[model samples]
Target: MLYWALVFFVVALIAGVMGFGGIASASAGVAQILFFLFLILFVVAVVMRLARGGAR
Candidate 1:
């Protein structure tokens, strides 16, 4: 999911460079959303692991 976020970010950059305003905006939005989702998922996983006594 994080990788997908990076991919979208790069795609947004490229679209912006190529002057596709709408595509760039949409891709950037997707990247931002994915990035946040990835962070939330990672935090949740860590919390669950700690709850299970798996964290040192």
Candidate 2:
């Protein structure tokens, strides 16, 4: 998930550099959404892990 976000971000940068405004904006939005989703899932997983008992 995070990897995809980074991929989209790189795509957005490339598109922006190439002057494809629409594609750049769309890719940026997707990257933003994926990054947030990744963060949310990571936090949830960490919390769940701690709740189960931290690394022995």
Error of 1 at 6 (Å): 0.6
Worst 10 residues of 1 by lDDT: 47-56
**Candidate 2, RMSD to the unseen true structure:** 0.8
TM values, all candidates:
0.95, 0.95
Model 2, position 20: C-alpha lDDT score? 100
Shift in Å, residue 16, candidate 1: 0.5
Candidate 1: which stretches are off by over 4 Å?
none
- Tens-place lDDT per residue, model 2, 1-56, is 99999999999999999999999999999999999999999999999999999857
lDDT of the structure predicted as candidate 2:
0.98
| Segments in model 2 whose C-alpha atoms lie over 4 Å from true places | none
